[model samples]
Target: MAAIQPPKAQYQQVAALLRERIHDGTYTADQPLPSEPQLSAELGVSRQTINRAMNLLRSEGLVRVRRGFGTFIRGVPQVTRDAKKRYAARNQGTGAGDVEIKALGLTPRTEYVEIGRVPAPAAVATVLSIETGAPVLVRRRHLFANDEPTQLADSYIPWDIAEGTELLNRNVGRGGSYTRLAELGHGPVRFTEEVTVRTATDDEASLLELDGGQPVIDITHIAWDAADRPVEVALHVMPGNLWRLRYDWDDPTADEYPTVDGEV
Candidate 1:
């Protein structure tokens, strides 16, 4: 067979078509996609064009590539802002008040490699409402989803509460730290989150599997205790292309809600 020329626009069109199929349930989540040769034949495009299209889909999080396995549709579903707000409300009274963390629908697996008392930095101390240089129990974590590093979180708990508790010695592989804090009587009653878009650092890029200088979403959150004292500060960095942030606000007095915020 003669070598087929690749068409860039055709490749993009193929990628868009595949994305639409995935969104509309034509290609179900976690199901293996047609092989490149098969897809090329079906779409009437060259295998090279199919390959490029698949790459685009993968980067856009519509598909996943396994080392020894074929490409599969990514199973994680996107949560809209309204859905997140509903989730947050539902989790308020439960022990799993960190439900927003779960609603992202990313499977979280944590490795607790270290737990020890360290002098709190000035910034951390200010957030925790403690004296600067106070002792705090630091928990270093590598958080993963589908076995891929999704977040690297460091949690700081005051030493007076955390060091003596089982939280120090236990390995909370999944739903560990947050659950333990709830058990330790410092469960978060309120949370404040701030989001910003910024370039990833070299270390962040390596750990989060992101391209250097690529834009990523930075979520800084402070979880507060029942008494409104800050219990933890968590920094989450997500691949900008793979995820989105959503928020919802309601004005109860208004008879009709206005969607004038340019959101949605």
Candidate 2:
């Protein structure tokens, strides 16, 4: 027999109604929400249950409460990021920065970009299969939407491959670094990304313009050429509250069981 599902709780029903109102503009940024007693009467629930729902909203950063005043809208993110679409676009030669933002009706810009030679940190070196403290070309940039900093990325390339090339330029040409690398016969054929999240440091907090107590996602990407040589290692940091990472599941096209190598 199939298991029976429990009905929605009183607090959950109240919270859903309030969320709908907020999304539909019934409640807006800085607008005060109805009092618990009023909501209780409106929803036919107890004041205590309504208060619980209000607290849930507060925890979600949707509302704030003032000691003598009432609850007010705090605001929510309008930006969304789909990881698969982004990477696939890059693989197909369309560079980053404009596509997604334009779809959301926001302006996108590369607010800052720089390239320089630097000693590879131990972490980056390990992922790139290079010597720790070895010289590498660092390409750093801050991605912005509507003039608000949203993402930061630092890409490390082997000095041998970057020296005396356009990769040294502040801007990485029309199709981005990957396209430039392809011309140099070191184009990336495969990439692996590892992700983790943690609290932002002071520098990260300032650069990303993150609010207090906001966390950031750290994504490390290791790119390999056709010969399986590690060509690039990039570190991306995104403010957790402003960006949503999306992943889509699909059935495997190749053999189901594969070993450490790509072979099945």
Candidate 3:
């Protein structure tokens, strides 16, 4: 005999109905959704079912809940420009060079947990073109905005080049290492970057206040001077959902390109 499927409750049915209404624009962006008790009575469902449905919407970014302020329909996702050249143009004259947080459009507050010379790890040595165990200046910083962790940056600069500079002794508010590097005569005119995404580790989740299983974006950058010498190697981990990467390209006839539809 075939196994029987469980029967759906009236409350489940009602929750589905309400979800459809919201999706169909019955509840517009930033519009206040009906209270649980009100929706319960109107849809003839229990409050618990309505709550569950709302939770689903929240996870999807379709709704937002404000403590003591009720839930509201989320605004449409902002459109992001994808041209790398356009991105550079937009950032031009923004004083974004050298760890300027404003160029990233994020107000940065930094916790300078450590700043000193350390033997380069194998990975750092490879990136900086230094031998293993070579001393390098390591700067570990926790960057925050609006009291939330925005990024964790670990910068490695060869000690021979970086030592005795204001970059070593300055606090977070002074300027970014990139800017200081220029002042010390090793300015970078070119940068190469690699980006990846993965689920956050336990420690990362705790520090970033991210939910378990939430993915974060990692960006590794190697900056080189005009002489093609590597000057700085930095790693950054950022919240996936709160940030968007934009690139503007000049070629209008390029054949191959990339695209995204919802979560990857």
Q: Which predicted model would earn the best lDDT? A: 2
List the candidates' TM-scores in order.
0.59, 0.70, 0.62
lDDT head-to-head 1 vs 2, winner: 2
- lDDT, candidate 3, 148-176, per-residue tens: 56678788999988878766774522335
Q: What would the per-residue lDDT of candidate 1 be over residues 172-226, giving only the tens digit for each residue? A: 4344555667888888767787788888789887776654455677776788889
Q: Candidate 3's error at 83, in angstroms? A: 11
The digit string of per-residue lDDT tens for model 2 on 126-207 reads 8878889999999888988776676898989999999889999876777778888888999988877888999889899788
Candidate that would win on TM-score = 2
When sorted by lDDT, best at the front, the candidate numbers are 2, 1, 3
Candidate 3: where are CA atoms >4 Å away?
1-107, 172-175, 252-264
